[model samples]
Target: MKHYVLVHGGCHGAWCWYKVKPILEHSGHRVTVLDLTASGVNVSRVEDIQTLEDYAKPLLEVLESFGSDDKVILVAHSLGGIPAALAADMFPSKISVAVFVTSFMPDTTNPPSYVFEKLIGSITEEERMDLELGSYGTSEHPLMTAFLGPNYLKNMYLLSPIEDYELAKMLMRVAPAITSNLTGTKSLTEQGYGSISRVYIVCGEDKGISVDFQRWMIENSPVKEVMEINDADHMPMFSKPHELCDRLLKIADKYA
Candidate 1:
């Protein structure tokens, strides 16, 4: 049995993986779904997460608890990719493979914030819709935060089930928009984060991330392999749970 660590995106928590977790566990794999800082049931406030490391503390601690001989398949969704990359960098040997599911996949060459900046740049003002972006900290060291709006959530879950969408509306939290730590000059090293095998899953119908942007990221930071869930939306765990699980299982069979 392989171990799978599922990481959720901005404004979401472990609860978002409700559909996918049971399926993976039923298939005899150990699935650990995480709620990043300030997300899900984690009590930390968004204001407390001043840096990328702060936001990723829970995930880092979880990875640290693994025995030296153990390795996991790290699966990151959407904004969770940045913290997942940080974990891979800090514990390369602990991760057999890092699967980016319609998530931002950073390159070793640029700072971790590059992909996020690209996304912001690509989005038009109208496209931003009701999604709320706020700032914290002083003007000299400002930090960003985002809260997904109801209408925006609708777009994100356009193809997902109504029940799952309701669950998200009930559980979503405010998330840091990258944070100052990611804006720093540090980049992932080839000997660290780059050492792990990486795979990218494209959600073709996702309006939240957009297929065009997802493909662009794939080209910008090439991965070991590329897979597609053509009918999936941004929330594939809800929109295409079984298909996502099948792809994950196939990846585990080959890579883990």
Candidate 2:
């Protein structure tokens, strides 16, 4: 059995992987679904957490439990890519593969926000205004300004075909302003990425992240695996957990 660390994106928590966790465990693999500080049910008041380093602690602690050859497959979604990349670099030999699930492929110095501007469309003045450092306090992260609207079916089809309206509703929250921390990706690239292999999962119908943007991301990312999901959305774990789990299991099999 192989060990997997599943990281959730902005506005999400370890709870995001609830549906997929069981499938992996039943298949006889070990999985740890982590909730970064201030996300999921774990978040209390905003004041409870102050920085990204604080959010990354639990994952690092988990890494300490293993030896150099213990390979951990890190799967991150959306904004979660930032930290997962850093963690992979931190415990180089311990991490075999880092998977981005509709997420950014980041280097050390790149701010998760910086990648967003490059891969997705250019930042609008209004959007820039909303996500500006002042908008969300240096202490808080901002959630998505806009989402796939309520065409209901059509909306989910393109971006997050994983979630239904009700489930999608609970999954959202105000992300912290710590996105500014992503400015460090350049330094990360300077250092070797170490022993990790990267896999990029691109969802074809994702209107929120967009195929063009996703392609830009793939080209710039360090990894080579680009798995396309036919009609999935941003939150494929919500829309198609079963299929996602099956694919993830296959990836795990290769490493195990």
Candidate 3:
């Protein structure tokens, strides 16, 4: 069976993948989902994450535990793409391909934080809604955090089921704004992160990350292929799980 590692985005935990996970497992694939530091059910406080490395600990540990010959299809959503990129860079051989689903895709030409900064710049004040952004570290080493407000969550889950929306409201937590830790970090290496195959899955109706921005990202850092779920919002896992799974299965067949 092919292995699929699903990583959730900011302010979300592994629980967010509940719908998608079952479908993959039913198809006879091994799906591994994890909670990054201070996210989901992980007990660590957000303050404990001071750097990108600190935030990516859980995923890195999981990758490290695999056998040298073991490789996985790394599927990431939203902000989860940053950590997924880091993992691919560090363990290129361990990743068959990195799939970014309505998520930020970084390039080897800029620091890991470039895409996030572009996102922030593109979002208008009204578009940001009540989402709260804060800092936990001092001026010298500023660490940022984001908490998704109810209104902001609504827009993100507009096309999703009400039950899933309620579930997110109950489980969402304060997430580390990875841009802070990645500020001065060097860009991904061509010989490492660039060597891995990449794919982009666009959510055509995503309000949080607009389709324009998604296309911009794809153009900014080109990938091997691009797929779209025309009616999906930002939370396709909850809105279009079957369609999402179909695309994922196709990727597994081609790359895994």
Candidate 4:
């Protein structure tokens, strides 16, 4: 069976993949869900995390632990794309394919934060009001993190049912410093990160990321293939778990 490492987005944990994990495993593929530092059940405190490298250590460590010739299909959702890309760069040979699901697919020229800033500029005034960068630190320890505004969870994240939105609010945490880290410079070469195959999954009804921004990222940093799930929101694993699983399995069958 092929191995798949599923990475969750900002403020989310491995728990987000509960729906997709079993479906993939039932189909005879190995699946591992990850919670980055300070996310999900991880004990790492947000105050303790300063750099992107520290935040991504969990994912990097998992990839490094794998023996040579042990390859995986790296699936990243939303902000998880940043670290997944870094992992692919660190172990190009170990990653059979990197699937970016409604996530930022950055390159040396266009990093994650660059794409984020551009998206910020393209949104409407009302959308701008809904995007808040909450401060979670004291004067001595400054922290800038983004969280969706009121009513945004249902509109941007859930798009499935009201109950799912309630669950998301209970589960969601403050995002790590990774988003800010993307604004800074990162070392990613064409041979290192670009060598591995990549796929992009677009969520047609995504309001958090938006289809236009997703398309912009795809155009900026091209991928080998692209897949779209209509009426799917930012959290497709919750909104369209079966369809997401099917598409993922198809990707694994074709590339892994």
Candidate 5:
């Protein structure tokens, strides 16, 4: 049996993996879901998070808890990619494979933050304005984080079934703004993270991170394999949990 450590995206916590975790556990593989500091159920407040390192504390702590002989498959989604990549670099021997689920696969020349900035810049001005108006509002400001309101959240994340959309509307939280502004830290090295197996799972209907952008990331940082869930939105864990879990199992069988 394989050990899978799942990381949630921005504004998300370990709670997001509710569906897939059970499926994986039922299949006899171990599952560990992480909520990065301040994003999920973690007690750390967003106002107290000062640096990117502080935000990554949960992932780092999880890695530290593992024994030397233990290795895990790191599954990351959305903004979780940044910390996952950093963790793979810092503790390559502990990670058997790194999976990017509709997430950025950053390179040394351009880290995940740079890729995120570019993703934001790639959107049309009209679309950007719409997103800002819909998801980000002044009343939710000053904490350096923003939340997606129901409408925006539905359109971007929960394009699956009606029930899934309703569930997300009740659960999503405020995501940090500074996750993409970090600088000066060393980037991934070929001898370190690059040596570990990498995989990318693309969510075809993802409006938040487009299919084209997913392909671009693969082009920049080649992976051992690529998997796709055609009907999924950005939150495939909620939208297409069965398919996502199946794909994860396949990857684990192949690489982990």
Candidate 6:
């Protein structure tokens, strides 16, 4: 069986993969769903998690746990893309393939927020003020609802076929502002991009991040394959598990 490491986005933890994990396991794949240091159930203390480095710890530990010959696949969503790209560079040989689920695939020349602003149109200072008046729950802050955006509320629940909005809502912890604001040590560009294979999965109807943005990420990364789900929105795993699985299995069959 192939091993897969699934990472959730900001303010989310391992819980994000609840539906897909069981299905992947049922299909004979070994899965490890992780909560990043400041996220989900792993926080030593939410505010105590002070930097981007803290966010990378859980993923780094997971990779370190694997043996030299262990075959691992990385599946990252949204902000989790930061760590995925880093880990693949840190331990290239063990990572069979990397997948970005409607996520960023950043390089040193580009900043994460810069790309987001560029793709969806930059958020004006006044807009930031409006978004900060959010209704969503965060572990440390109550203003995360702003990130959800007008479109996030509409399409997030519809992206996947599964009903996971309640769980996602409950797990809405405040994300550390520094992950993107501060800057990462390096990007996929600064590191070796050719060491492992890369794939990009586009959530066609995504509202938080658009279809055009997804294409931009793939066109920019050192990607080898592109998978699409037109009917699904940002939360494809929740709305269209079968389609996501078909594409994943294809990747496995092709590489494993």
Q: What does the lDDT come to for candidate 4? A: 0.81
Q: How accurate is candidate 1 locally (lDDT)?
A: 0.91
Worst 10 residues of 6 by lDDT: 142-151
lDDT of 6 by residue, 157-204 (tens): 665433477667656765654334334434445444457788889987
lDDT of 6: 0.69
In order of lDDT, best first, we have: 3, 1, 4, 5, 6, 2
- lDDT tens per residue, model 2, 1-256: 9888999776567877888899889988899887776677764543444455555666777787887678888898877876676677677778777888888666544554567546435745543333322233343443222222234224433444434445655665555543444233243543445356778888776754667877787776556577877667877887778878877887777754
Candidate 1 pairs with clashing backbones: none
For residues 42-149, what per-residue lDDT tens digits would candidate 4 score against the true structure? 988766666666678899999999999899999999888887887787789999999999997777665545665566567787766655666655665555676655
Q: Which residues of candidate 4, in runs, are more than 4 Å off?
A: 135-143, 177-183
| Candidate topping lDDT | 3
Candidate 4: 10-residue stretch with minimal lDDT: 177-186
Higher-TM-score candidate among 2 and 3?
3
| Model 5 alpha-carbon miss at residue 77, Å | 0.8
Cα deviation in Å at residue 190, candidate 6? 5.6
**What TM-score does each of the candidates earn?**
0.98, 0.79, 0.98, 0.91, 0.89, 0.83
Better by TM-score, candidate 6 or 2: 6
Off by over 4 Å in 3: none
How many Å off is the CA of 204 in candidate 4? Answer: 0.9
Point out the higher-scoring one by TM-score: 3 or 6. 3
Candidate 2 TM-score over all chains jointly: 0.79
Q: Write the per-residue lDDT of candidate 5 for residues 217-241, one digit (tens) a residue.
A: 9998889899999999998998899
- Better by lDDT, candidate 3 or 1: 3
Model 4 clashing residue pairs (backbone)? none
Tens-digit per-residue lDDT, 1-256, candidate 3: 9999999999999999999999999999999999999999999999988777788899999999999999999999999999899889999999999999999888999999899988887788988898899888887777788999999999999999999999999999999876836445699889889999999999989997889989998999999999999999999999999999999999999988
- What is model 1's C-alpha RMSD? 1.0
